[model samples]
Target: MAEGGITVTIDDAEVRAGLARVLAQLGNMAPVMEDIGRTLGNLTEDAFQASGPGWAALRPVTVARRGSAAPILQVSGGLAGSITHGGDATKAWVGASKVYAAAQQFGMPQGYAGRTRRGAPIPWGDIPPRPYLPIQDGGLLPAAQSEVLAILTRALESAVG
Candidate 1:
């Protein structure tokens, strides 16, 4: 079973064999994965820009890497604390990189009002969910998805041809 992100499986031995040959000729899968990642990165960046002000100002980062287990596609980055709305503030979260992002995107209780050790008031307050990741109808932009599919199809055709 695939443990990480997206997974592509080919059950046909012939197709798998062809793909293996093509991969061998290509020398590595990084280039293909990178191509896909770049496309997604561009779309994500565009979405962020179109979402609104705070999101528009953010920069997106896309990374594609081949791990021992599977290939990885990571798209991240944006104005970190830009989710703070009126009467809300940012906090130092000690969890996964996306914890705060999830909170901001999915929403959390509005219960943060206090001061730091230096006595500086923390504008911590309830944050409403402001989703910016999907950037479309609960998924990647249609055009972007089509482009990615075309890329994969081309790769497969090249391998089979």
Candidate 2:
């Protein structure tokens, strides 16, 4: 599993309380965590399919290099296809397994000074952040948070019944 990724934790008081109740009743949260992971993975893929809905548009040079009308960050679909999710009872996660995933997600600033093995600049030009993990500003986006809350609510309902 990739270590560079978002760690989703519900901070909502009501959801937390409900999760606590469910946890007490179930004694194991593996199923819920797995469901959360799958949900996050699907959301991440949706972001990719939407060409990173909230992300910056691709530079003209980048589009020209791709040589086709391919979506941003999807030249060969390696990065997006590498996205996956897994977890145990304690936690869940979704992220790309590609080595350049971090660079694509966070972007490299201009004048990064990093060089490739062939002595070329890692980023010939500035690459704006194109977050595809359903996160924004160090937290889950509102829609993703709401979906997670819904998952927790369903779990709680199942536990109660």
Candidate of highest TM-score: 2
- For each candidate, the alpha-carbon lDDT, in order, equals 0.40, 0.76
Pairs that collide in candidate 1 are: 110-126
What is the per-residue lDDT of model 1 for residues 1-161, given as tens digits with 9 covering 90 to 100?
11211221214343335435546656455655566555655554454555532421221221112222111111234333222211111111111133245544444454443222244332444445554443333444457557655665677677667
> What would the per-residue lDDT of candidate 2 be over residues 7-103, giving only the tens digit for each residue?
3343556546656777887878999989878988999999888998778877777778778656788888899889988768977678887766777
Off by over 4 Å in 1: 1-27, 52-99, 112-126, 135-144
Window of ten residues with lowest summed lDDT in model 2: 3-12
Name the TM-score of candidate 1.
0.42
| Best by the lDDT measure | 2
Question: RMSD to native for every prediction?
Answer: 16.0, 3.0
